[model samples]
Target chain A: MNVFVIGIGLIGGSMVKDLRSLYDDIKIFGLDVNKAHAEKALSLGLIDAQTDYDELKKADVVIVSIPVDVQLEVLPKVLDHIDDDTVVMDVGSTKLKVCNVVKDHPKRRNFLATHPIAGTEFSGPEAAINGLFKGKTNIICEVEKTAFKLQEKALKIFADLGMRIRYMDPVAHDKHIAYVSHLSHISSFMLGKTVIEKEKNERDIFDMAGSGFESTVRLAKSSPAMWTPIFKQNKENVIETLEEYIMNLEHFKQLMIDDNFEKIFEEMQDTNHIKEILNGIIVNA
Target chain B: MNVFVIGIGLIGGSMVKDLRSLYDDIKIFGLDVNKAHAEKALSLGLIDAQTDYDELKKADVVIVSIPVDVQLEVLPKVLDHIDDDTVVMDVGSTKLKVCNVVKDHPKRRNFLATHPIAGTEFSGPEAAINGLFKGKTNIICEVEKTAFKLQEKALKIFADLGMRIRYMDPVAHDKHIAYVSHLSHISSFMLGKTVIEKEKNERDIFDMAGSGFESTVRLAKSSPAMWTPIFKQNKENVIETLEEYIMNLEHFKQLMIDDNFEKIFEEMQDTNHIKEILNGIIVNA
Candidate 1:
């Protein structure tokens, strides 16, 4: 099988690395707008060749792993070049916009929209590693739109990578992802901004930051080029989640200001349910 | 020298374990309102004996590692009971209120108000581990109020545990801590609450939650009993930080709504300063 991955950043690079190890006969080709990333991916042996759009026509599988905004522009073009036998998939965070953009395409049935719920804040091909998708959930949206054989091919590839699959509508995927993923990025970025603004002395942040701050702010280091479009693509859901988040923060703030210890204590205790929820997911899954 | 730790929970228990491994002749006594916690600490060898508060008088050093609200109520009494030679210190998050409450006490000179910039979301004696404080910062406030000899002794002990010491006024400590630590807890708790509220299906959250959600919401698992009074004590600073955070989120929301990709991208790019700041602090300190 010939696999071509565009935008050899973290996710794309990691996919190539993990897949190449599993299928030695897989001929991997890389395409990235950033020449440095393409060169790094080659040096790192993430792919067998650095190819262009024309080369995509020969691919048995094509993976578009660019920023969400770029994915909207590049995905259609990649789909246009690939034959009916080619299985095209995208690993973008927001699904609705991409799915809608390609809804009427002649080869739409050959494409699958998936989001492997796995990533570190780090980006680019150098950040890729094997086993990233292992034991993690991969959400596939609008599966009914894809041809049965193509869907089987995509499912087999993901299952071979040790991923559990779930099906959902693109719109539902965007909404759930806004709450679980995009909002986290915004919260973390804002936190980093808030602390930086208040604690002008960067040294103080370093001296004071513990594991809590580190973990909470880890996503702040995420690539802006990658995330800016995700928030833009899922603006409505992001806004709703942000409003609820802000209101929750305000409510807790007011409770604090009033020194209503009883209410504050109760609210925190309720939220502590997250412990059981997280533990259950981690231990059982 | 004999050391007595009041409240053998996460912080206190970890301190006893770390200190015992360092000092061969030091006798450590444990006390916890939770009798199970005291017995567990004894069994874990975190303490030589499970003793009573009346025995505090014989302690060469008495460490009060209790909840902030409880510390305000019990620290004074502990100070009253300790011998003139006993160095009494409380490791609490908010320092201003506790420092002010103990300022006029007759035994004020024997007490040191310290905040160790170290902890995980997990609490209780079982969470205790060796070397929890190594390479972490220990903030000491109102040192002038502490007897010079007692202050020296406290510094020596923290140094022995491999902690870097920083001195600041109680007011500044509380204000800075509210932004750095307390604000993070609220952010995490509310993030968890918002997701739980929006995604009623816990299974959806379990499947959708990646490392980003996990890291951003990790502190939601913290002890409410430990954090409620912290917000209550540092209400003003907490309110100010929350307002700034909410304002930033609102601005980001507007940017997303407007599709002002340039502004959104720039904002996140700027916050990327965290990489440099955090890395610098980690490398230098």
Candidate 2:
């Protein structure tokens, strides 16, 4: 089987790493707009061959793992390039935009919109490693839109990688992810920005950063090229979530201003439920 | 030598765990307002015995690991209760307030203001684990205020636990910590609150939380009992940092609302410098 992985960065490179090692018979190919990433992926043994989008014609499975903005433009093209029998899937973060774009396409049955809930703050092919998706949640939005055979094939791959698959509508996927994923990124990024803006001395940051600060700001190191698109693609949900986040922050600030430590303490106590929710996740780290 | 550990929660419990294991001669005693915690600390062997504030006279070393607000009210009393030869120290997050309160005390030389930059999101005795302070930074504020013998004693203990001690002025320590530590907690609590409020479904949070979300929100699980006091004690610096965090969030939100993804991307790119600083620290996770 020939597997074509597009945008061979962290997600795509990771998929190739796992899939190639899992299936000895699979001949994996890589396609990335960044020539250096394709070269890196090939050299790192993430793929058997470096190929172009035109070569999508030869793939038995095509994995689109680029930024959502690029996926918006490239997914349909990749779908159109592949034959009906081929299974096309995306590992994009935001699903609604990509699913909506390809939903009307005649070859929609061949495509599956998946958001694998796993990643580190780092990015690019160099940052990729094996077992990145192991034991993590993989959300397959609009799975019913996919053909049965292709879905089974995708399921087999996900199973081999030790992912727990969940199904949801693209609308729900977008909204909920804005809360769980995108908003966290925004909060972290802004935190790093705010700290940098306030501290002035990077040396102090290096000195004073505790595990808590490091953990809270870890996602601020994520690839802007990747997340910017996600934030923009899921603008409304992200905006709505960010507004709520800001309001919560502002209210907490007021509590501090008013010296209402009791209320502030109560608020965080309620949010401590996040511990239970987080415990449910299988961290790839 | 005797060690009296006040507030038998994460910090004090962890300190006792390490101190007892490291020093066979050190007879550790515990005092906590929460009886269950003191009982649990004794049961877990975190302390040799559960004692009370009145027992301060019997202690060779008094370790105050309570919340900062309580520390303000209790520290002077503990100092008065302990003999002049006893080394009294605090492991509170905010040092300036605590240090200021004891600056003019007759036994000020007996007191050491310190903050160990180590913790798990979880709290209380059960959340306390051995080696929480290993290879982490420990901030010692107003070191000059401590007697030479006591400083040597505390430094030896920190060194025994493999802590890299950084001496800081109490004011500078509190301010820098506000940006690095306290701000992270607020951002995380607010992020968790916003997500919980918006998602309105616990199961969805459990299903959708990625490692990024989990890391960013991890500190939200911290004990409000512990943090509320720190926020209240470090109000000015925290509010300043929180305001900066809010402004940054609002600006990012505006960028997203305007579809100015390019600026947002640039902003995150700039903040990615956090990676360099984070990489400088050893993450115990």
Candidate 3:
């Protein structure tokens, strides 16, 4: 099988590593707008060669693994160049915009809109590792719109990579993902900003940070280029979730101000349900 | 030296395990309100025996590692019973309340109030592990009130355990910790609550939680009993920090609602300072 991957950053690079490990005979071609990242991916042996969108016609599968903003811009162009038999997919975090943009494409049936629910705080080719997607869920949005054979091929590939596939409408995917994923990134980034703004002494943060703070702030290190578009693409859902999150924080703050120990304790205990929810998911770390 | 640890849960049990490895000949006694926890600590070899509060008087050093509310209730009584030569210390997240409670004690000089900025979401004797405190900061509050010899003895123990010592006033410690530590816990717990409440299907969370959501919500699994009191004791500071956190989230939400891409992108980029601060700390996992 031949796979042509664009972006060649963390997710794209990691997919190359994991896929190559699974099928040594597979040919992987990398593409990136950043020349340094493309060269780094090649030197890291993440791909057989650096290729252009024009060469995507020969690929058995072409993956748009770039930042969400770029994915919207380049996905249709890449699809236009791919052969009718080739399967096209994207691993962008936001799906509604990308799905709508490519809805009227001539070969729209060949494209499978997916958001593989897996990643680390790190980015770029150097951050890629084998088994990055193992046991993680992959949300396939607007799957019914894709050609039956192409959808089957994409599902098989994800299955081979040890991913559990979940189907949803593009709008639903964006809304739920905003609550579960995008909002987390924003919360972490702002928390990091608040701490830095208030605690100007970096030494104090380094000295005082425990595992709790480290884990909570981990996503703050994620690529701004990647997340900014996601927040923009899923703006409505993100806004709704962020409003609820702020309201919850405000209510908790009022409880604390009132010295309402009973209420605070009850709130924390109620939220502790995350233990059970988290236990169900396999943490990649 | 003889060391007695009360409340053999996560922090206390970890302390015992780490201290035992540092001081081979040290005589250690464990005590807990929960008999099963004490028994488990003993079985795990975290201490030489499951002992009583009275046993603390015989020890050269006593560590009251319990919940903040319990610490405030018990630490002063523990001080009353300890020998003049014995150094007593309580390792609780909030220090101001505990310090003020024991301020007028006859043996106030024998007590050293410290907060070791290290922990995991999991609690109980089973969660204890060796080297949990290594390379972490041990914040000592109101050190001037502690006897010079007692402070020296506590410093040696922390040094032996490979922890860095930092000094702060109890009031300042509570304030800074509210932002850095307490707010992280509250944010995580509330995030978990908001998502769990929004997504009626718990299975959605299990299916879609990526590394980012997992890291941000990790502290939601913390023991409610342990954290409830810390929030209560540091209510004023926690409320202030929570207000700031909510205000920041609200501002970000407005930007998202208005589709202010530039502002949102800039905000996230600004928060990337966490990468530098985190780089300075040793993240265990």
Best by TM-score: 1
Lowest summed lDDT window (length 10), candidate 1 chain B: B276-285
| Candidate 2 chain B worst ten-residue window by lDDT | B276-285
Top candidate, metric lDDT: 1
Backbone clash pairs for candidate 1 read A9-A124, A10-A124
What is the C-alpha lDDT profile of model 2 across A30-134, one tens digit per residue?
888888888888888888888877788888899999988998899889988898889999998888889889978999999999999888877888888889888
Residue lDDT tens for model 3, A101-212: 9999999999999999988988999999888888888999988899999998888889988898889888888889999998888889888877888898877787777878
DockQ values of all predictions? 0.79, 0.73, 0.73
| Total backbone collisions, model 2 | 0
lDDT of each: 0.89, 0.87, 0.87
Alpha carbon deviation, residue B176, candidate 1 (Å): 0.7
lDDT of residue B171 for candidate 2: 84
Q: In candidate 1, what are the lDDT values of residues B81-145, reduced to their tens digit?
A: 98999999999999998998898999999999999998889898899998999888999998888
Candidate 1 docking: what grade? medium
Which consecutive 10 residues in model 1 chain A have the weakest lDDT in total?
A276-285
Clashing pairs in 2: none
Q: What is the TM-score of chain A alone in each candidate?
A: 0.98, 0.96, 0.97
Docking tier of model 3: it is: medium
